[model samples]
Target: MNRPPSNILGKGWLYCTVFLTGAAVMVIELLGTRLIAPFYGASLYVWTSLISVTLIALALGYYWGGVWADRARSGLSLIIAIAGLLTIIIPWLTGPVLLATDPLGLRLGSFVSTLILFSPSLIMLGMVGPFAVKLSTATLAKVGASTGSIYAVSTVGSVIGTLFLGFYLFPVVGSREIFIGLGIALLLLAIIVAYIEHRHLKSAATTIPTALLVVIGIGLYPQIANSNRAESNESFQTRFERESLYGWVRVIDKPKENIRLLTVDASTIGAASISHGENLLAYQKIVTLLPALAPEMKRALLIGQGAGHMAMTLKDYGIVTDTLEIDPAVAEASIKFFGFVPTGKTIIGDARYEIRQLKGPYDLIILDVFTGGSEPTHLLTVEALAQLRDLLTNQGILALNFVSFLDNGQNATLASVAKTLAQVFPHQQVFIADPDTDFNDFIFLATNHAMNLNDESFPDSHRTWLKQRLVNIDQSQGMTLTDNLSALERLQIRKSEHYRRMIIDLVGTNHFIR
Candidate 1:
């Protein structure tokens, strides 16, 4: 038997094609999250949908590609080229697809949107692997070597893609631009491969103009979409917007209400009214009560600086406030737009990690970190709480601002977190921002010393309200949130879903599209 031709292209072109296709696959997966996050939020449900869709698409593509390889070896380039083109089209379609499905709820809406926008491109790209193996193999004897070599090359490409996109591309460029760049890269690769395999000048020539048109369309889509969103709601205006390592950050100004809102991944993290120049959110205002409850308030540490409203408020009371904010972009925006001044210091890093390295025996420590509408589970663990406790002075107080529902079964996370805090601090007090509402801020104040709610420093108006909402000290019993057993993510999802529904009802679906 003839050794089917020792080489496909003289020098390693097949490997390069496989490598590029691999890179494209990972790019789609990573950037897909950012693309949908603004509409559905970057929650467990959104991530789960994106991953599940990619796997299912790849599985179907592998099967179909194998069958196609048996029938037409020459069609590999055409298949990949078409897939690249389709990938380009996906980003363009994202806005419309999300708008159409916004009413379906986060879980179902995200799943349907992922299926419609991402599956086709991923399936097509998945076909490249099996097809590459078929084309590269010279004979039955070398099948194993060919398969292994192609896969190894593809795997290496995936690693490069993940690292480059995550570390470099995402931080520098916006999500929509990243998608556009990936699509352009893939389309160019497809044209090159087609020319190499079939010497098809005619096909490549046609593809060039089509690629140009696609890029132009992508550039125009965002502007048009923004205009449409603005026309939909004249009262709400996006004052500032930027892509950050964590997610999309936006500062929206509601001129009618004289409020400026800070949002990360569609969750309202902070809001300050222009008229009062203070945090408009009820939960944030409640954090100010900490200084009144604690015995001493000279030095304070804030774990999260959402627009720095709470920190600024503390500064006004003559306390030295040091804020630790994870996202530098958020910290910068807070100062520039939200009246956050560096009254004491602004540390940029993770709250949990920074807390351990701090030289602190602070009089007050406030925990307000959140991501995608929920507290990060890592920061709520028993071990983390213990570390924070050690950073406080003997008379210091730790106040946590979190959102949870207090209706029996829905209060598991609230109970667990309070239990964990109690384990670290002997004396603890619970205050719900609103006693009438089940879903609202649940502030937990813990200290080694007993807290006096009747202290003269307490705000006169809030004294009675805070006293009324204090949970019975005996009721703070439940499973503690140790590092290993934290269920904050699951609990937060329930509240996030509720928030999504409320927003949709109040503003209509267009509120989410931008």
Candidate 2:
């Protein structure tokens, strides 16, 4: 029992391999959300599935890797090489995995899809740590120090990986390219280990084919992706599509229907009549009628600028519309594809942070923020509502576009939001896109003073429909959502499922997988 002789790699290369694998694990985990988001959405269920699967895979890998390492102190290179291969094939496997799991529904589909697409590579990656520790250790005396140093290096790599990938890589690099880059890095590591351990040209030469295959895959990816998208979506065509810090931003056109849709992940945030250049969405139409409530309203603050439809509507009423949108890509798409021009300041950042900086005495503040059919829970809190209330003029109105079921049993998120708004603004009125359906867009109009909906200043066109959809919300049902206490994700599970099914019906299942 002596230490294994090393020529090519030594202990230093072993540590480097561990660091790279650790980074690979995190990059894969983060990228999983982006891949699955188009089909299943970036919901609580999707995140839960990915995180749980990563941990479960790691646990299994650690146990099996330890057992295997004890029996044979070789094959670390084979394990790394296999993991690299699996990582390389993930993009290829993604569409099939998503299609197969679509029938399972949101919760189960997301879990199963994540398990199928990522678990193998993640499990293989997890094995690297234990094997590296065993290979690097010279004797029983140095085992503890070796284990500590190895894991410390791995953790440091994971930290840097998370920061770099989330901040720089995602914004600039395509997910496919990033995946290919990671696979290439891992393959190189495996080759180094193989050459070091076997001390022969053949050992390193075996991994070269796999490296070339990955290069070929990267070159052919654009064709594969375009073919898939075209084959899947026959009815509509994509005008613009790109990945942003927020989610997948796509502008789709339906020639038959003559409508262009602005979609973020699985949710259709906004839609416009292609020939007319007017908003086509029922929710947007109703939400834009906020100026009817306050005739003299001169300025408005829109929290979510989806295709700039609402901003455009407000501007039509001679109101200066300042838009706050989190995703820059969405803003760009709005301007380029939908012809959205902001009359006022166009601030691009999270609503929670940006809301504070605004020197707003806004006449109307429209909060229409929705991501993948779920609102950011932080912005729905009572504390957040109060900040918005401070910005409103004395006779100003706050119009919140919420999508949920009308039934009391299934309206936890809606009720909680209504209750939260009540804590800040004394007067409130709720309206729905369609009162007959249980699931509809619920627009909550809150004001510091009385809402004069009966005023003669209100237009006759939308007045009749607005009065018909007006409904009362019983805030007593669910506890108010506060900064300290909010479980909007759990509350919106049923709504998310319904939303996903509707999207599939509207756009077809193929549009989601890509």
Candidate 3:
């Protein structure tokens, strides 16, 4: 027996419902990353909190949906009601999550707070799929098709939501308003669907309650999110850029004074502009340290590429240099802020991937990609190192960064990183890049040539400068990130609840790691 045409439309509507629900759930979840990132940072813990919260809510939604679906008796009414409820409550819920990120420190744990603040909304959003599908298919024969249809639709919605939010909404209003506005949009969609399915004016009566909630939600948006680049004058020109939940980036230049600054979130890194002869800003001190280990700079690769300080040094020596920067914005900034005019090739991709793609016979490869106490673990892994080493010249040099201690004390991650590099570099030399701040600074110089800190390896020129900056002290303990170790090497430290906790403490609570 053939089913009536009404069944097909029912299936289509059900699919649409499932997909839109999924789309909404994902959009908010992705958006959530930005909310807590400003407070706690975009670190592993933030990821931990984000993933855990989403999964837990999803599980609850699935269980509750299964039980609640049967009680509805009328699939269409339940679907409309759920869709409507999503729209109204989300806007009302957006403000509280943002407000809860205060006392920004590890102690406050923005990740945990955000989880609690946003979970209910997410849990409700999560309930859309199973609930939508269950109602559309009461029998086993239709269940698979119904479920798949819903999933597919939701995925499509996810694509639309992600693109819309990432490119258009978040950039203009930032995550704060994006969260509330998206919530309003989702709520309105639900109300519209409810009105369509239930023509009774009473069925559409959710408008008043939803409207009241959205009014308050709109009031909660934070005023300052993304204007740093636009507002700051050309004097503080931005050279490089990267946009992530972590923060917006700007490599500011003050050429007349000879200084460049790399600002991300609220923190910054900078040095003197060579064009202005203002004296190298604090960052270029790395080059002063590196040459002590190996004098050769025939051809090199520099990671991080900020305002092209290291590259500038290399170019001055007539050394050809290639740069690996993950953000296109940084390259664009290079032109505007640093007057860095990139010569030769610059790859806008992860260092790990770019290194593997290299057809190089490089004499030196310097790593400068650090934002506070973190860098991509993969970029430091054995495989990444091996691929990088393959690109090195016969007597080439490899300079890796390891934070010693800053403002506070010894950084365990940096100590560990030093230890790991020691395992690979063996006789490698470690140097201080930014000397003015005595907290601690390091450059892991790996070379086959025998070099010592006292003589040619630690040149008199750089050493004298380091002494002047007051950063000559040594750090006894730190984290190990070496080429010889397996990728799983950091697993114990990475898995430790304490390690993450310690970082929360070291980087400051409000300073999130993503």
- Which of the numbered candidates is closest to the native, going by highest TM-score? 2
The TM-score measured for candidate 3 stands at 0.73
Candidate 2, residues 1-514: lDDT per residue as tens digits? 3435333346787778888889999999999998898888887788999999999999998888888778774777778877887887787788888999888988899999999999999999999888888887777898899889889998888988999999888889988768867876777677677766566313444455544544565565565444434353567998898988778889999989998999988899888888987887777777557766777899999998988888888888999999999999999999998899889999999999999999989999999885347558898888999999999889998988888889843366777888888889899988887768888888888998987678787787767888898887777777788889888878888888888889878888777665
> What lDDT score goes with residue 83 in model 1?
74
Query: What TM-score against the true fold does each predicted structure earn?
Result: 0.90, 0.93, 0.73
User: Which 10-residue window in model 3 sums to the lowest lDDT?
Assistant: 220-229
Output the number of the lDDT-best candidate.
Answer: 2
Please write out the lDDT profile of model 3 over residues 325-378, one tens digit for every residue.
875666666556656755558878888777778899888888876534334666
Candidate 1 stretches with Cα past 4 Å from truth are: 1-8, 200-232, 370-372, 408-410, 454-463, 473-478, 504-508
- Residue 440's lDDT in candidate 2: 84
TM-score of 1: 0.90
Candidate 2 backbone overlaps, count: 0
Compose the digit string of candidate 1's lDDT tens values, residues 1-514. Answer: 3233226364288789889889888999988888888778877788899999999999998888888878864555666766766776676677789988877877899999999989998998889888888878887898999899988999899999999988888888877667766766776676677666555212343345544544554565455333424244677787777778777777877788787888776677788886776777786666566666663678989888888877778877788889998888888788888878887778999887888889998998889875337457889888999999998999898888777677742377677777788778998888877778887777788889886768777777668878788865334545778888877777677777787666545335555553
Q: What does the lDDT read for residue 249 in candidate 3?
A: 60
List the candidates ranked by lDDT, beginning with the highest. Answer: 2, 1, 3
